[model samples]
Target: MLQTESEINMFNASLKGKLENLSLSSFRDLTILNLSNNALHGTIPSHIGSLTKLGILDLSMNQFFGALPLLLGNLKKLTTIYIYEIGIAGTIPQVIGYLKNLLDLVLSNNFLTSSISLTIGNLTKLTSLYIHKNNISSSIPQEMELGNLKNLIDLHVSSNLLTGSIPPTIGNLTKLTSLYIHRNSISGSIPQEMGHLTNLIDLAMSYNLLSGSIPSTLGNLTKLTTLHMGENKVSSFILQELVSSNLQTSLIPPTIGNLTKLTSLYIHRNNISGSIPHEMGHLKNLT
Candidate 1:
């Protein structure tokens, strides 16, 4: 009966053992395979690629290790892939770009290394991408054309060795609600284009090599609630009034008062100094 089955779900089943003996290759018509939250351990089976009709694959919370099999690129119909926290190591394969139908791709909390693949631009349909909490290194290349993923809503690449300024093209992702690039080695001033993220609610860029004043444009994110910019080389203040003043006093910009919905604010370990702005009181929800 496995030959005719289209989906196999063993999520959180407490199943233990490698998939080598599961005979999954017999399921020719399978379209979905979920083996998450199990004790499955071993390199992902190479023959799993034979399931050409598969659309969604989840192996998260397993004990799988080693590089992703290149044959995964053959699963052209795949739309979602979740392999979070499975001890996978090695660079993300460029073959991932072959999955053009992908919408959500989560590969967080692994030992993956090397620069992000530039071929990711090919996944134009992607909406949410999580590759955080890994050892991925190198500057995010503008050539990566992150802007090409116009449908993106959540982008997380934090806690890595990433350097270089955030590509200005990120402003093109106007639909973004959460953007996290904190805990990396990124340098340069925050791009002014960030102001275009009017829909943003959570923005974190702390613990990096970022310098320069906070962009007044950030004040435009009226929906923002949590904003963290601590532990950086930011040398100036946000309020234009303070910026224009010849005095070195760095006051919290009154424009921050505009984000009335804000509840969490982290600005510690910067060069900011001066009297706290009374406008901060407008953030009645701040904690």
Candidate 2:
């Protein structure tokens, strides 16, 4: 029986209360469940794993607590799962790697800790993954592979306790437009392979223990708009190359005058030395 529009709205709104005692076997044609921003509390019902046809499940901004249900992996067709900003605690369930069709997975701003699972490499179709602002520590999963995510665009894993060098293999994500891996304990040199990301528009790798000269190859990022590598151990020469490149800021390298299109530059708080280039006077926007 087809319900009226108002009736359907009422049903969805009260569905949580009704599901308090719901058994997974009773649900039918319920392919999309979005209980976000609701006051729903308690662990997700284990029976939810039976919803094999669910495409999107959002339970964010709630008081739900406990480890993510491993049973959700049974939803093979799931595309997006947002469980961030909730009281969800514990390690991410390794079973998440089973969501073969997942495109966007956000579990940030939670109580999740421990190293990311290597099984994440299995989600080859993912485009956006946000697991930042958590208590996760240790070197980035060296085994974490993303070579198959050719369509990936944004990756944010900042503000955590991550350590070790960033893998050069990350440059394999040629389709990436934005990459943020800052405010961590990451050390080592910025991979020269990063220049391969010609499509990158914004890149941030600050407040870490990273040392070495910035990759000269980074000058190849003609599409770049913002580049933040400050607070790391980088050389002034690389900063000059960034200034001559596509950056759009004034406080950057004096060579930045070459980027006639830059409108806002911030290069303060570093070992950068040398007088401001007089050529900067040529940029009317810099005046």
**Candidate number achieving the greatest lDDT relative to the actual structure:** 1
Off by over 4 Å in 1: 1-4, 240-249, 268-274
Q: Show model 2 residue runs off by greater than 4 Å.
A: 1-25, 240-263, 278-287
For model 2, where is the 10-residue window of minimal lDDT? Answer: 3-12
The sequence of per-residue lDDT tens digits that candidate 2 reaches over residues 1-287 is: 22332111121243344234545445544566666666667877777888787787777776777888788888998899888887787887888988989999999899888888777888888999898898888677663465555668988889989998888778788989988888899998888888889888778787888777677677677666666666666553644244222222324455555545444456544444456777666445532
Best by TM-score: 1
In terms of lDDT, model 1 sits at 0.83
Q: Tell me the TM-score of model 2.
A: 0.83
**lDDT of every model, 2 decimals:** 0.83, 0.72
